[model samples]
Target chain A: MRYLKLIKVFIKTSAQETLMYRANFWVSLLHAFLNLIVAVLALVILFGQTENLNGWNLSSTLSLLGVYLIVSAIRNLFIGPSLEALVGLGQEVWNGQFDFTLLRPVNTQFLITFRIWRLFSLIDLFLGGAVLLYSIFQTPQSPNLLAWLLFLLALVAGILILYAILLAFTALVFWNPGYLFTWVFDAIFQLARYPLGIYPVGVRIFLTWIIPVGVITTIPAQVISGQTGAPIVFLILAASVFLFLFASWLFNKGIKQYHSASS
Target chain B: MNHRGGFALIKATWFSWMQYRSFFFVLAFGWMIPPLVALFVWSAAAGEGSLGGFTRGEFITYYLVLVLVNQITYAQVNWTVGDIIREGTLNHWLLKPLSAIYQALSSELAGKVVYLIFVIPVGLLLAILLKPEIQTTPINFVLSLVATLFAWGLRFAWGFWLAILAFWITRADSFLALQDSLVFIFSGMVAPIPLLQGSLQQIANILPFRYMVGFPVEILVYDLSNKAILFGFLMQLTWLAIAVLLSRTLWVKGIRHYSAVGG
Candidate 1:
């Protein structure tokens, strides 16, 4: 409960920073719309040639893309911005300014993970939700309330999986702050924009188990499209919980590994 | 342009950038994922059957070659040109002994050299494992190389001009992001140009985007008529010329505008 209020305060301050750059909102809106158009255009062209790709059709794939956008927006909103403040290009750890963050009264992980935000990404969140809604309606059978509940559960799992993965990568900054470790992760994450089944078995296994980007987007999409079982959803929820705990442990280990750059 | 000075600058840039080769390699791998995803998706779609005149083997070859072509022509340097202009760093470039372009050019060449070190081996490994089928004459290969050079020139000049707009507008990077989306859609990254239907095919053929990365790959992989290859080259050269003109004009005008603001 205390953490929730802290997040609200963090968001309020971030909102003030965002509002100072009004043009950025318009730029972000345009970027979101352009990204949507590109995604939809690609789908239109792909589906135009073949009715379905592997077992996934255009609508199901669009659902995956929508989930991808939502996950990405959520990352951009807080997960990306906050962690990026610590370890991104020319950021805190790079410049030895992270000592200031460590000196704060709050927990280091909690502060670093929630203190900064790019509110402009809220535009992408709305656009993604709209796409998901539209794609859901386009399906032959609309999701029932239970399906919606499952979808939300899977979506939350997906987001947590992504967060854990990013947090693990962010923690690597302690070992080597010069390299942007998240970039390699970003490359792998791009694969999540499509259904995992479309990849070769070997590649699919790697993305699903090693990186789990497949679990981050494909499972939630599968739930929305009514292609997944409830057990699988709960299984993913458990897996995400485990991954989060492991990542938190790794972050704490990394915190201990941190040596002040200034000294 | 002083050829000796430019050569020296590129050497210096390459050695300086060697320290960050791993980062560039990761970025290159990220750039390769989209085409790799397309390759797998199209190959799976074409299992036991063809999609839009492309067999599974042909799809494999097309995207394998495309991975190399896309990496070669991609203008990663242009991403920083806007920052250089906006952050008052352009003044440093202006005072350099070599032409201002050498600053951009050196980084561009060094980045390609670094990125290709990773991209080529991965592409070759994928090709060997995937077993891409190819039947191209030496003449076709030579023409494809020439087309690739033209494509790089067109893409670099076009993106440079867009970045130069930072002298007038604070948010010129938005335009760069918009251009990337357009290129991804029209440049046959999503699907082979041959697979595109009616108006979309015509639009892609007419746009400068296809001339950037897709035309060269299409030349090498697709069995096109002489007239079609000639037309592709013609369009590519025309766009390159136009882009060069625009880049030159924009730099001159933008420098005047920038100096006025500073003065």
Candidate 2:
């Protein structure tokens, strides 16, 4: 409950900060629209060549893209902005301002995770939802109530898994403050925009087991698309929980290694 | 222009950039993801047959070369040019004895050096593993290299002009995102231009965006007729000339606007 209140305060402050730059809203909207157009155009061109890609049809692939957009928007909304401040180029950890964050009474991870928000990503979220709904209608399978419930659960797990991966990358910043580790992860994460089955077997296994970006978007998409069942959701839920706990442990260990520049 | 000063600047930039080679390597890897994803998707679609005259092996080779070509031609320094103008740091560059353009060029060359160190090895590894179809003659390879150089010039000059627009509008960086979307669609990143429909193919041919990254890759990967290759080069030169013209004219006008705004 205390953490909830803290999150509200953090969000309020973040919203206030965002409101000062109203033009950014328009810029983000235009970017979101352009990104949607570009992604859909790619799908259209690909579908023009063939009926399906590795069993994923135009509608299903669009769903995967929709999931990608939603997950990306969520990341941009909080996970990205907060972590970028904490560990991105020449930011808090590099400049030693992270010491202030550490000295605060709040749990460092919780505070850092919720401190900053780019509200403009809300537009992206809306656009993603629109695409998801439109794609769902376009597909032959209409997800029932139970499938929708599973979709929601899998979506949460997907978000958690993504957060864990990014957090793990962020922790590496403590070991090498000069290196922007998340950029590598960001590259791999782009693979999740497509169905994992399209990749070669070795690369698919690597993305699924090593990075797990494959499942981060794929499983939720699979469930709602009526390609998989509830068992997969449980499996991914376990993975998400495990990944989050491991990431938190890594972050804590990294925090212990910090040597403040000011100190 | 002092050739010695330019050489010294590039060398100094390279040395400074070496300190963050790992970070740049990560960024380069990230840049490779979109093309890599397309490669897998298209290759998988081409399994056991051909798509638009491209076998699975041909798809692999096309993207593998594209990964290298795109990395070489990508103008990352253009992103910083906007910040330089917006933050009023252009004044310092102007004060330098050497041309201010060298500052951007030095970083661009240095970054390419750092990034290619990582990109080339990975591209080679992929080529070895995937066994991309190598279908290039000596003459074609040499001509492709020239086309790639022209591509880099066009991409850089085009982006430079967009960045210079920062002197006139506070949100000029948005144009960069717009440019990226255009490149993603009109360029062969999404799909090969030959694979595109009649009108879309014509659009791709006409757009300057394809000349940036796609033309060079296609030149090396595809066995184009002599007339086709000549047409590609003609289009490449035309766009490069236009880009250079725009960049030069914009810089002069932007500088005037900058001083008028008391920059």
Candidate 3:
């Protein structure tokens, strides 16, 4: 109950801070919208040139693109901004200002994570939803109800997987107070632009097992396209849970190594 | 005197970058992926043959050269500008004896010098391993060098103009991100300009974006007639001139309205 109260306060504070800069809010919305348009146009151009790139047809590719945008939007709206804030917290800790955060009765992680909600990323989520729906409408064959349900489940799993990955990356801040890990994360995320099957077998396996970027968008996309089965979905869900737990463990471990600059 | 000052600034920046040896090495490793991935995809598409007029060897050469060209021409001043505006660090620079633009240019040059330590070795390894169909003509090489320098100037000026928008908008980072996405598509980062369809191809040809990465890379990989090469150089110069004018106007106007709100 205390945690819930703290979360509510954090959310309210973030919303107020976000509203203080109205021009930034509008520009960020317009920027996200333009990004969505560009993604859609690129897909349209690609599909126009070839009915099937590699083995996947237009509808399947579009569906994959939808998943990519949705996953990216969610990351941007919540995880991305939160991770950035966490990094700032790390920086503050490095510079001896963490005492202010520590003095508060609230959970430090929760406070740091929810401190600055980027309201503009919500625009990205909305645009992503619109694109996903539009792509669904354009597809000649509708996915069954079960498939849609599975897609949602897979998306949840994907988000968990992404969160786990980010948490692990952010944990590095305890050791190195800079943007190194963030850049690596960005590099991995760039791979989500295309279906994983197009990559070499080694890369495909590495993305799935090591970085897990493939699972964030591709595996769920495969499930939605009806290219995979129950076993893969189960494996993905289990992996997501395992990874999250592992990341949590790592975070706790890294915190013990944290030497506050104030000390 | 102005030209000499500019040259000195560039040289100073280069030397400063050498001081942060470890950071530059890490950054170079981070940046190597995009071009490497592009080369991998293009190679796969070409297989044992050719695709869209580019053989496997030609694709390798084009992408590797592109990696170098992109490194040399990248304008990270946009990122710095956004950061300075957000953090109110611009005030410190404004108070300095040197122009903030010169400082930015110097810092950028320093980074480039440091980055070359990594870029050069990896680029050479890829070139030798792949044995790409590279053009060794003196005229093409000389033109490419000239075009690349002009392209860097144009991109830096354009990015500086965009960054100055932070004076009016806090979340100008979103616009920069959008610009990056557009450049990825239009600047032949993913695929060559010739591979794109009719209208898109024309847009890529006419836009300054192509000159930033593709034009110089094209000069390296293919033999263009003197007339074509001259026209490309002219286009690059024209865009650079426009960017300089835009940045000058924007900077003057933005500083006039610069109400430093936060530190």
Candidate 4:
């Protein structure tokens, strides 16, 4: 309840800040539009050659693209903006202003994560949603209620996994203040844009198990698109849980390390 | 304009880049994966059958070659130019004895050298592992080198001009990002130019973006007719000229428009 109140305050503050810059809205919309065009054009060109790629037709690929866009937008909207403020600038951490954040009567992670919200990030979500709906319509398979449920679950799991990776990277900032790992994460996100079935066997295994980029958007997209089963959902959910726990543990350890380093 | 000063700057930047070698490697790894994914997808799509006149081996060669070409031609300094101008750092650059282009060139050269240190070894490794069919002629190889150099120069000039617009529009970064998306679609990064449909291929042919990354790859991977090669060279020179002129115009106009505000 307290965090909810805090998030509300943050959202209100963000809304005011966003409103002050109306140009951001247009720029963000154009960015999403440009991204959509590129993704769609690529799909069109790829499908022009042959029909199905590892049972992924143009529609399935479009859905995958949609998921990729939405997931990336989610990162931009909340996790990226906030984590960047924390670890990227290192303004608070490097200059020891993060001391003030620690002294605050709130959960530091929660405070950091929820404090910044880019409302313009919704433009990508909206665009992604449109693409998803259109692609779903084009797809021959109409998934049942169970599949939809599983798809939503897998989506949540994917987002959690992403956050876990981000949190772990930010935790490392306590030790190495320079070099944002988020750039590395941004690069990895490109791999997740395509289905893992395309890569060689070695890469497939790495993306699926090591980084979980394979499962991030692709598995959820597959489940709902009728390409895979509900069992994959459980697998992803388990991975998400394990990753979250590990990331939180690492973050706590990093805080301890920070105190020791400063002392 | 001072060659000795430029060499010193370049050397300094190169050494500075060595400090952040790991970060660049991480970035290069991220960059390498997308083309790898495309390589696999196209190979799978071409499975035992040619797609758009490209054999499975040909698809592999195209992407592998593209990985090299794209890596070599990519100039991402425009992403920073907006920040430099917006923050009034461009003022300091203007006051420098040597040309500001030399400073930018220093960073550009340093980054490329740092990138290639990782990119080449990885390329050779992939060449051995993936066994992409090697196709080349002595003449085509020489032409590819020339085309690749021009591509880098053209892309950098265009992006730099776009970045200089920060004097007139604070949202110049947004447009630079949009230009990147255009390149992603048209530069044969996603698919070979021949794979695109009639109008799309035409657009790619007309646009300077194809010359930026795709044309060099095409020259190396496919046996183009003499006419095609001649047409490509013409396009490359024309675009390079236009980019230079546009950048010069923007540089002269933007300086008059830019002044440090309130600080």
Q: Which structure among the candidates has the greatest DockQ? A: 1
* TM-score of every prediction relative to native: 0.96, 0.95, 0.86, 0.94
Chain A alone, TM-score per model:
0.96, 0.97, 0.91, 0.95
Give the lDDT of residue B255 in candidate 2: 76
lDDT of each: 0.89, 0.90, 0.78, 0.86
lDDT of 1 by residue, A206-255 (tens): 98889999888999899989899699999999999999999999999998
lDDT tens digits by residue: candidate 4, A7-54 = 889888999999999988888788888888888888888888888888
Order by lDDT, highest first: 2, 1, 4, 3
Among residues 3 or more apart in sequence or in different chains, the pairs in candidate 1 whose N, CA or C atoms overlap within 3 Å are: none
lDDT of 2 by residue, A148-262 (tens): 9999999999999999989988898889887666677777888898999988889899999998999988998888899999999999999999999999999999999998775
In model 3, which regions exceed 4 Å deviation? A1-6, A88-92, A96-116, B2-12, B21-41, B47-49, B81-101, B125-136, B161-181, B223-227, B245-263
DockQ for all candidate structures vs. native = 0.83, 0.83, 0.37, 0.72
Query: Compared with the true structure, what per-residue lDDT tens digits does model 3 show for residues B153-193?
Result: 98999899999899888678887887888787888886777
**Deviation of model 4 at A6, angstroms:** 2.3
- DockQ score, prediction 3: 0.37
Q: After aligning candidate 2 to the native by TM-score, how far in Å is the CA of A222 from where it should be?
A: 0.8
Which window of ten consecutive residues has the lowest lDDT sum in model 1 chain A? A178-187
Worst 10 residues of 2 chain A by lDDT: A178-187
- TM-score order of candidates, top first: 1, 2, 4, 3
Error of 4 at B86 (Å): 2.0
Query: Candidate 1 residues B15-44, lDDT tens each?
Result: 999988777877888899889888888898
